[model samples]
Target: MNHDRSHALFTRASELLPGGVNSPVRAFKSVGGEPFFAQRAQGPYLFDVDGNRYIDYVGSWGPMIAGHAHPQVLDAVARTMRDGLSFGVPNPLEVTMAEAITSIVPSCEMVRMVNSGTEATLSAIRVARGATGRSRIVKFEGCYHGHGDSFLVKAGSGALTFGLPNSPGVPKALADLTLTLPYNDFEAATALFDEVGIDIAGLIIEPIVGNANCILPREGYLQHLRELCTRHGALLIFDEVMTGFRVALGGAQQRYGIAPDLSTFGKIIGGGMPVGAFGGRRDLMRQVAPSGPIYQAGTLSGNPVAMAAGLATLELIQAQGFHDALEASTHALCGGLEAAAREAGVAFHTTRAPGMFGLYFREGPVESFADALGSDAAKFGRFFHAMLERGVYLAPSAFEAGFMSSAHSEADIAATVDAARAAFAVVAAA
Candidate 1:
């Protein structure tokens, strides 16, 4: 519990890096505390610089599906590093990665690699606009598709955590072109498409929203979007960066039985490394860069090290029963926490989709960003600190979803529930 070393590091970091962290949420601003610096991570736990051990549920923000430091992923990265790091040129590993992703997710007939989720989404929007010759884009409230300028309107995750839905630097002209709608609301989407469908270039969504704490689309919701886009001549782009391999092998699209015109992937694909991709129908993807004239390029798009790590992670998740087991574990953990909250007489609600889950300090279902806002942020902050004190590390912001890893065991879930039981009592008393 002593974070002396971490405190010292943060003091120095605050003078150097903005907010003393590379990422905003990592500063623990929403949770009312300084962040703990991670010394190392193993299967399902993070050992902090202060020597406190915690059962990790964030999974490095949804990329460590096979868990931290998996031997296979490590070995693959090590082997690839022996050859070289960044080629800035095409590598065979990149081709293999493309093949692996295409085989798993049928929607991605061809893919272009990028360094981060933001790049993948930004590039995807560009392709959609170029291919369709439209200037407007549509996104849902509380659904985050990285920090691209067009996506900053009503953005979730870190933006929501810090109360900055609209950042200062984005131009009004650009913001005016991006439309926002409510997720799971079919009538609003239908009405909007009817009005300006022709001007809309693309509609991007997180099929299973993780940024607003794992809100699942209502029954027939995704299908409705697909149909609307087809009718409107707008490309349906699924941003599956967090849910790609974690929700299911083929992702939310496969689970929902809906195929989008384009898709963006990140997190699990990199296996803890920094990587991302955007792909879709051969005709649409062909319009990008050297293949055609859409023009999207990256110097480290297909870094050998990233490809090797991604390929290995994909291979491991493809094993039989991988998703089934992960889903069951997530269900178990969420169910246990609900029971704990009930026994503690606390108002609590939770939602789960395969390996991803959310916790809310409110009653009943949370269906959208508006509903998510009703949850008690201050109360959840107390619960977060309580659990952290009990050796369980959750996503610091209440707006962020918690991820379960294949590396997590029943014991870890059980220990987490026990901690939650005690934490809920503290919140209830407050």
Candidate 2:
């Protein structure tokens, strides 16, 4: 529970890094505390510089599906790095990665690897615009597709956590081109497409809406979007960075049984390494460089080390009942937390999809951005610190989703529920 070393590190970091963290939410500004500096991570626990260990649910923002520092992933990295870090040319591992992605998600006939989710999304949008010869793109409120200029408008995650959904530097011109829609609202989508379908190049969405605290698509909602896009000639892009391989082997698209025109992937695809990819039907992907007119390039796009690590993780997850077990863990964790909240007489709800979940300080049925926003952020902030104090780490911001890993066991869940039992009492008292 002592964060003395962590505090000292933050003091030094504050002088160098903006907000004392590389990522915005890590500052814990929304949660009302300083962030803990991790010394090491093993299995499902994060060890801080103060030597305090925690049951980590952030899972490196959704990539550590197997767990932190899994031997398989580490060994893959060690072996791959021995050859060289970057080749400035094609590597066999990259080919293996591409094949793995395309095979797992059949919708991606061809995929382009990128350095980060932001890059993958930006490139996908460009492809959308270029392929269709249209100007506007559609994104939903409370859905974040990385920090690209086109995606910053009405964004989620850190933007929502800090109450700045629209960042300042994004130009008004660019903002105008990025249209926003309410998530899980079928009528709004139909109306918007009717109004601007001609000018719309693509409609990008996080089918699972992880940034908005894990809002699942309403029944048949994804099909409606697919139909609209098909009729209007606007490509449908699934930004599955967090959900890809985490929600299911084929991701949310697979779970939901929808095939998008374009798909962007990150997180688990890189297995905790910095990597991303976007692909879809061959004809559309063929338009992106070295094949057609549109150009997108990265010197370290398919870094061998990253590819090897990701491939290894993918192999582990492919084991029989991997996702089934992960899904059960999510249900168990959420059910226990809800029970603890009920016992404490605190209003609470949780939304889950396979390995990812959301915690809300409100009632159930959180199906839209507004519903997620209605959760009491202030109350959740208090609970966050209380849980952290008891050796459990949740996402720093209430707006971000929590992730579960294969490394987590029944004992870990029991200990977490025990922590929450006390934490919820703290919330009830507050």
Candidate 3:
């Protein structure tokens, strides 16, 4: 309940670090409060420096799927680090990770590891351009594929929360090369592809728009994109940095039964470490770096510690009924939140996938970026602080999706719902 220590830390940090945080959302700019600095996390709870414990739904922006500081993951990291930290040459863990990925997601025949989702996405687009020899890239309006220069145009997440969809300093020429389309719109996609499909190198999407608060693709929408890309000779890249391994075992592509030409991944694969990857059809991935002419390399591409943690996580998720339990938990959490809102006489809705969800201070059917923007963000901000005060940590911004983990027990979910009941009342009163 006390953020005094966090506040003191922020005072010192702000003097040296921009906004007193390494990441923008952590500043709580959208929620109108100073962020709490976490001391440690375990299971589904985060303990702040002030000794306050909160049930965590952000899951470190979607990597702690098995929960925070799982013994298995920690053990793997500890054991791997004992041998060495980084090796310039290829390590066996990297091969095992690649095997795990390719086997789980059949679409990724060959994968290249990177340090972050941003790097993976940047590398993917380059492969798209090099292979196709085209300059234009198409992305959806509310999909946040990291802060790559081209992706910042009409992006989501922190950019949307701050009202800077088109960030400054991106070259006008480069911005022009990146085209934007509304998600879940059939006609807009058709029209755009018809207009400049020839010039387009790739069309990348989030599969599930996690940044704009977890909007799902409409029926057959992904298939339509696949058809368009195939017909137009443009690569289809699924930016599954958020949805990968969270929505389903093989990500949204498998959940929706659509296959993409290239896919970029992060989050769960790292198991709370900093890692990312991009892979897809062999021909397309083969064009990246040493294999072909397109140059992309990372000094720590296959960090053994990260690989060990990720491999442990992958093993855990692959256990029987892991995804089924995850889906049930998501539904239970969303259903309870909706009921709590109803009891409080407040207008609220939630959109959910297997292990991720979005809360809106509005009615149902948040299918597009415009619908997401239509939510009462100011009211949501009030509710956010109220919930945080009650020991439930949702994502800092209404624009970001809240994650669920296999670590969250029914007791945790019930506690979260109870917290929401009181928090919703506060919102209603305000």
Candidate 4:
């Protein structure tokens, strides 16, 4: 496929934007190529500037559950835009959004909106510290909670894609306070909490580790964390930015039957718009600014446009069988791809949770960050390019998870599996 226009755009962008892209993974650095610029997206496909069409599996990094350019979401945003854009003041839609979220996720008695996942997570951490009067926070390795300063330690997503889990600018003092632990390891977490349980303010986790390629928690793992936090006087904060509505209507918490003390949401909550939120028990959320002592404010927190889009998206996902269909489609796609890899004699494996899934160029189950890294990166890069050439666009980096949309049809899955069959052959030869 000719990417002449995309190449020219990247050339200009490189001189203007760092790495010629707003996001690091979009640069395709880990996959050994320049990125393709998206001209437009509709349903389950992306049309690039070069006129190449691809069946999209990234789903705009897990927010397009209802799929791109859904008429309902677009109509809602358009209608809201006719009134005004940013009010910088309270709006009814904001209240509706808060109500909708709280109604869906019982753990969130109240919520505060922000512009991005990073803000939601950072603010959540602040609230935890303020409410508990503690200085230390715990996060898991390969579980990304956005790029907040405290979270950059052993973070996943773009940080892991570029081989820099610990960024340079974070101060040692701040980094020292952010404790890192392994996911799915109960003994280590138990031991750590026993040692410094008092100093730790909260434990933040992805619940389902999408950033490290969709690693699910082991049986009873989340319950263990909940128990430990309760015993340690630490808040359990679930970062559901990627999994919120995509995984299930109520998210991983509902699926696992565990309720956290606090939760952060983004991605699907915005319906492809820029939005984020942090919320929890009424008593804990009451501590946030204007309500109590803890301070957290945003100039455009409840922007009308974002709220409209989010509300519409949430409404659509709530329809009966929405999540069930999405989960089945994802399972079908992953299963087909695994069969293709087997036929091609490629050492490959995959994992899935509802609408989210992961592909690895390794054998057997990938349970942790170390296991994910053990997959052959070189093989993944080859397969990524091979699939891209065949009109199937997977996530640009191997470390990232792939998402499915309700808009994806069985025909799309069949076409994708056919492409994967050819791609796996190329990867096996490589």
User: Each prediction's Cα RMSD?
Assistant: 2.9, 2.9, 2.8, 2.9
Residue 175 CA displacement from its true place in model 1, Å: 0.1
lDDT of 1 by residue, 1-430 (tens): 7999999999999999999999898999999989999999999999999999999999999889988999999999999999988877789999999999999999999999999999999999999999999998888888988878888875434211212338989887788778888888888889888888988899999998898887999999999999999998999999999989888899999999999999999998899899999999999999998979999988889889998999999999999999999999999999999999999999999999999999998997899888998899999999999999999999999999999999999999999999999999999999
Off by over 4 Å in 2: 155-165
How well does each candidate superpose onto the true structure, as a TM-score? 0.97, 0.97, 0.97, 0.97
Candidate 1 lDDT trough over 10 residues, lowest sum: 156-165
Candidate 3 on 88-132: residue-level lDDT in tens?
899999999999999999999999999999999999999999999
* lDDT of candidate 2 over 244-359, digit per residue (tens): 99899999999999999999999898889999999999999999898989999999999999999899999999999999999999999999999999999999999999999999
Question: For model 4, what is the error of residue 331's alpha carbon versus the real structure, in angstroms, after optimal superposition?
Answer: 0.7
The candidate maximizing lDDT is: 2
Among residues 3 or more apart in sequence or in different chains, the pairs in candidate 3 whose N, CA or C atoms overlap within 3 Å are none
Model 3 lDDT, full chain set: 0.91
List model 4 lDDT by residue over 96-124, tens digit each.
Answer: 99999999999999999999999999999
